[model samples]
Target: MWKKWMVCVLTLILSMPVVACEANPAPESQPAQQTLPYRIEVLADQLDVPWAMDIASDGRIFFTERPGRVRVIQSGKLLSEPLISFPAPFISEGEGGLLGLVLDPDFANNHYLYVYHTYKEGEVTFNRVLRLREANHAAQIDKVLLDKIPGSSIHNGGRIKIGLDQRLYITTGDAHEPIIAQDRASLAGKILRINLDGTIPADNPFSGSPVYSYGHRNPQGIAWHPDTGILYSSEHGQTAHDEINRIEPGANYGWPVISGEQQKEGMKSPLLQSGDTTWAPSGMTFVSKGPWKGQLLVANLRGKQLQKISLDATRPDTVLEAATLFQDEFGRLRDVVEGKDGILYLLTNNRDGRGNPREGDDKIIRLVPIQP
Candidate 1:
């Protein structure tokens, strides 16, 4: 009877169930296929080393050629006559020239245009910021906003942009003297914020100077977030460590002192870094309105392509995605700006001595968004 009971109990336990330790979850679904939503059109060709461009509120597109000429494209027609030209002593050497340009916030009434370029004083050469009056034929220099920032052949950071706060911001390279980037008294290797009249902003981080932030190394591209109003900058590292940083008041971006993967207290790290690859990023623009709205369109010279960086809506400084656009289709892109008409414009740097210039080298191309 006992043996029969044991057999029955064993059978009951065996028939209960077989339990495994853990069950495997199914694999996550693959991401959706990315479809680019823009078609390129040749807006203007034969441009010689176009560096930066901005569309005026009056729908006039003004651009700068590195050889010291400012050309206008009105009503989609490239004007045969040059709008303005810089005279002698404005040296176009190495990585320097008439680099950054911007129209005034009140340009319609004020008629002010600002530029950052390399200039010579006696035997000394330096970079400066000038505000000029745009007239019918030529522009007149109204004010020399800031001058005598240290300049070098290669590291003369000459990109400027107006922030949402209506302040003019400029980036300066270290003049190849990395030590100066850490000096608060010097403007080299720093991001400067100044008033429209080229005076120091009352609320600047520096008490009486225009030094907004310090410790930068050849920052070239700067733009403001349309939503969050934060400022972003792209800079070149020594050999590696191409970086994208969000600028803030009194912030000291780790440069000269440190590059990437190295952090210290009171020093800020970059948002994104290209570990060992050189993007050689130049001018960048934030798409204001279109299918690619809120995205940053950056021009890469060494990379010879366009990079579209998607910003996190909730955190504008956070980079959500980054992809190369028109890879090698246009050689050595230099600048990108969004037109008021919701079209994206790109400037090629093929004529910049280092690039492979095609037939109509260094052209201006527009990116037309595809409609669903």
Candidate 2:
């Protein structure tokens, strides 16, 4: 009877479940990871080195191809024929060609468009800003707004935008001459502001001069903050120190003298820099809606990504965070613009002689933000 009772006790002890105690217990839950609010969709494909773009109030998209073609997309379709083609045989080697296109603020009434392109006169290379008139689905050169900007096979900074004040802003590179960036007299390496009629603003920082700000190496993009109207510029830095700067009138950005975080007494440092990383940032725009509103999106060429930059809410000049999206998904992004409907439009520059082209080569892509 004792042996049977011991066996029963052993069986009961063996049948009971065992629980081990952990030194540190995990929390009940973990925070979920956050994701981007938009997905990319291809709007048009097979484009040839599209450089810059702008959307019209009627939903028409006007863009410039590096090879002197101005194409249009209407009703969600890219037209087979270009709206107008700038006379070729111009200098398109490297970064020079037909670049920088923007529609007039009063385009609906005036049907005016502005463009910047490289040309040669008597063996001298130069860049000019021209106004075009569009009628009957065709455009012709209307007037030469500004001219005599130095151009080169590389470092021909060409990006144009009309500000809220109705003044035209143009970015010009140093034309491969680094020292000219500090010379206020040179049109190269400068941000120029002019009236719609191509006249220098009376309130310009320099009287009778179009130079708004100087000391830029190769500034390729410029955009104004949606709420503050503060202008920002994206510049290609020497030795992988790409910069995004808050532009002030007559301010010196210190191109060759200082880059990245190096500061000088009278020069304004960049709001954000890539440090050792090379973004080769091109066109940039501010988000107007959704979770990413007030942030800036920059298209990177060599980095082949769309860089999202957040700024401090209290300090508009301070950069809060920097992140990237769609890395290597598209080859060589050139421009990103916010559409009138609060969506984003992107351009791929694979065929620009520097990227590995995919099957479709170049494309126009759209990003629709996910609503809450």
Candidate 3:
């Protein structure tokens, strides 16, 4: 009788689904005997190509549409009208368009917002960082802080953020010109920093130049570590070796000089590399102040997944473990931002030329931990 009951129990258990707890499941040596804590929820849908986003002071989500609109999601709804729209001069070519967005540090008081986008002049098209003033539900164009960044149909690096130093940092691609990435004199293929008024900080690594670091192929993501205040970047690789780098002032990243397995003198090596695989990483952020606080969340474009990179106990230079989330479930992902309320907002890039879009395809999905 006891043996018959045990057999029935075992059959029931075998029919149950296995749940995962660890961000990355343990190796076969040690199994994962746990259940995942969080669940993903779609906050809004029926949107266009949502690229980058920033949490507004009032808890609203401000995001950019790759075409040329600055949109908002308020009270859990995708607002129909855009906060502001740019002219048709914006070239929505291959990779060029309205790309990144961020709010001023003192957005509550200043109501200023910034964007990184691609614009054309006669025949030449390039990227620029523009500041705008927000008031009464609308934003007005302000200073063109930085402009004329080298751009191309594909490799237009357009991630911008306000660093811990209270300065604007912008990343630019090689404009498809691999040679310029090694040129210190060119702003293309470099991370540039400037004051709010578009002036170069005197304390910059390069005294008079806005270049913070050089020798990059097509960097797409930049975020600061919460504990150490160190800057981290996500860069795209040619055939393989997508990288996450620890940014050091004036350091070279060895773009055309050395790609995948090669590293040279004076060029700082990346903290992590995905060999023979392309994450095609985009906007990234750290989950600061949550159960998964220190984990770095990256949105993968071509890989069509959300990846989590965990640091070691000492929080040193190396990644301890890595895992994927929503693998191909939502198509391509463009940005992942952690809101002040500890919720993670993931922007879907399904409407982009390369992705498979459904009716009302692109969306912003919110993730929250399911507490025990």
Candidate 4:
């Protein structure tokens, strides 16, 4: 009787199929098709390297010209004069110039503004975060929130955004040193979260550190999901694999040790990974409403196009790469943002000394979805 029972149990166990729960499943994912019909339109021309841009509540578009000037565009025209310009100390060599900008949630009330740029000391040094108050047509420097963040002429990560909770978040690159990404004490290669007043949030993973997540090579883009309020970042990969990561407070993204999809024992994989050729994703924005509401719009740099990625938080593999439109028209697209009118805005980095610049190199292009 005991032998017969054992045989029956063995047979039952054999009938159950083995399931694979590995980090990287076999047969990698393929890109998806484009859902919405859209067209790209050139808005401005001959501007310097436009790094980052933000839409003001008053329906004005504010963007940075990498040579150290902030300009405004209203009603599809570039303003003759710049809004503000930093002193010589703010500009750096290659990727450093005026990089990021964000307005206070209560811009009408406080009129506070924030900027991220590489501060030079004798020669090109590291990047720093500065805050100021914006008045009628000028800005008053209030404080330097964080400084001495390792900066490289190449991989200086310069993107900042305020979350739905009103907390400030900044993304820093590895400064060309891959090992710095794994070091918790170093500010390089990490996403930092802090209070508006430059104090570290008490609930951060580490006791006194401002780092929310680590192990990033060069994270240039960050945005919050309109529905879930969860943070998402676009990180540049080394030779292959540009990533769209779903950021968690205490998570590590495994930079030097891992790139895109890793099969290691304990490494957080990317939510979506694209091959070396077709995509070099930069700034990303979530479609707030309309038919494309919940989809992610990723701006490509090398690939010279904007990719629409469908995301499913529960199943990471559900990130389908949609259309790769505007392949060569807007050379080396840098940032993709949604404006107040719900149209998408793209910043072209053609004049950045990489691609062939057309007549109006380094221009801001806007795209609107049309009904099919």
Candidate 5:
């Protein structure tokens, strides 16, 4: 009877389910991959060395081809014909050609746009800013806002923007002459501020000169903080020490005398400097919305990336972090602009003679935010 009871108990225990445990638990099933904050979309492709671009309030994009054509993109399509082709031929040597474009603050009403380009004045290379008036989807040179800025095959600084004060701000390169950066009288290697009519403002740093700041090696980009109203500029260093400077009204940024954290008496050092790394930074803008809102995005050419900068919350001049994106994904980014819809647009420079062009060669890429 006892043996029969033991057999019955053993059978009951055997009928019960057997459970097993894993020592590693299969690594938690490998969590899902996180999505990126933004995705890239090719808005316009097959462009020819698009240098700079600006979006109008009406969602029209006006950009310049380095080969002297002012192209337009309207309603999600690139216009086959240029809005206005310059009657005068451009120098178009080395890095010289058409560059820098911006729309007027009152663009919707006045339909005015501005451009900077390299020109030849009796065999001497120079740069100038011209105002264009658009009517019936075509534009004409309305006025020459400023003229006779020193230009060269290289170092022809040509980024223009209207500041919060409604004044036109222009960046000029050293024209490969570093010494001229320290010369207060020279327009090259300096930031100039003028009225929309191209007149020097009464409150300029110098009593009668338009020189806002001097001692820039080759400032290719400038942007203002939306809330702080502080101005920032990106300059190409001698070779490696590319700089991002907080611009002041009369400050002398050390160029030839100092670079890459080298400080001198009465000279301002860069807020951020690339040590032994060449960014060739150009055409920056403060992001208005999305994941990068309130930060600064700069387009890099030689470094071939988009640099994102985060400023310190307490100290407006301090940079908390600087990160790079899309390294080598797009060959030689030239300009980055933030649209009214909070999207960022990038222009690739694959056909700039320095990069290996792919099938499309150059393209306009938009950073579309991934919605939650």
Candidate 6:
């Protein structure tokens, strides 16, 4: 009886599954596994080629439609009418129209807003950055500051932001002319910085000009690191090598001559390269003061995803591609910005005639990061 009992006990023990546990795992330790802690929720739909966005102090999100209207979203609903609309002369063909929008740092006091758009003058035309103030009425325009800068219907780089130094920084594309990127006299394919009143800062690299850095090809997204204060930009590559670069004053980012990491003397290589056909990156935002703090969030148009890159540990110099979310559901993500409440807001680009749209197409999505 004892031998039979022993055999049965041995068989039961052998059949049970075995689990290996670490001898001294910390009680509060998190697993090393990487995961996306956000749930993407669609806020509103039926937008047309929405390019960029700025969140107002009152939590209203204002964004631009490439065809010349600026719209707002409040409390999960899109406003019925445009806040402001430009004349037809300000809207050009392909890559032109109302492109970028930013609020003045002292907007509460000055009520100033800036915009970048393509304008026409008889036969000659150019992309111009304009500053306007809110008139006594909410939807009226008051002023224009600094207009005319050389434009093309195809490659108008229209991204503007106010830097920590209280200066406006603008990113311009190559205007489909590769050589223009290297021309010091041309504003095409360059990053520029200027004072709020539209004057070049005396501390700028180019004495009397707003040129901060040169040699870019269709740069769309610009963001500053939370800890380092260093600026990071996303560039669109022609056929290959989409890049993310760390911006420095007077530094030249190679455009037509070099795409990725070519050993050139004066050019700076991208910290990360998307390579040929994988990603066409657009607007980016850094997630600060959350579980995702220190991670760079990038919106991809062609790839149709929101990619996160962890850069807090490094000096914003290393590029580590993290979990990509919302690619299959959103169609194309154009711009991403972090809300004051720690939620991530995304602008979908499906209505731009370049993506496949479903029932709720061309929408603004809010992603709330959840605790894992």
User: Candidate 2: which stretches are off by over 4 Å?
Assistant: 1-33
C-alpha local distance difference test of each model: 0.83, 0.86, 0.83, 0.79, 0.85, 0.77
lDDT tens digits by residue: candidate 3, 63-99:
9999899998888887888999988688789999999
- What are the per-residue Cα lDDT tens digits for candidate 4 across 279-347? 667788888865567778878888887777666666544554455666676779999888766788899
Q: How accurate is candidate 1 locally (lDDT)?
A: 0.83
* Model 1 poorest ten-residue lDDT run: 20-29
lDDT of 1 by residue, 73-146 (tens): 99889998888889988999898899999999898888998999997788777999999998875788899999
Q: Give the clashing residue pairs of candidate 6, or none.
A: 126-151
Among all windows of ten consecutive residues in candidate 2, which has the lowest summed lDDT? 23-32
Clashes of each: 0, 1, 1, 0, 0, 1
Any residue pairs clashing in model 4, and if so which?
none
The Cα RMSD in angstroms, rounded to one decimal, for candidate 5 relative to the true structure is 22.7
Give lDDT tens digits, candidate 2, residues 193-284: 99998999999999999999988999999998888889999999997978889899999887666677666556678887777779999999
Cα deviation in Å at residue 7, candidate 6?
92
Model 6 Cα lDDT, one tens digit per residue, 173-223: 888887667666678899888898888899999899777887788888899
Model 1: CA > 4 A from native: 1-33
133 Cα displacement, candidate 5 (Å): 0.6
Model 2 residue 176 CA deviation (Å) reads 0.7
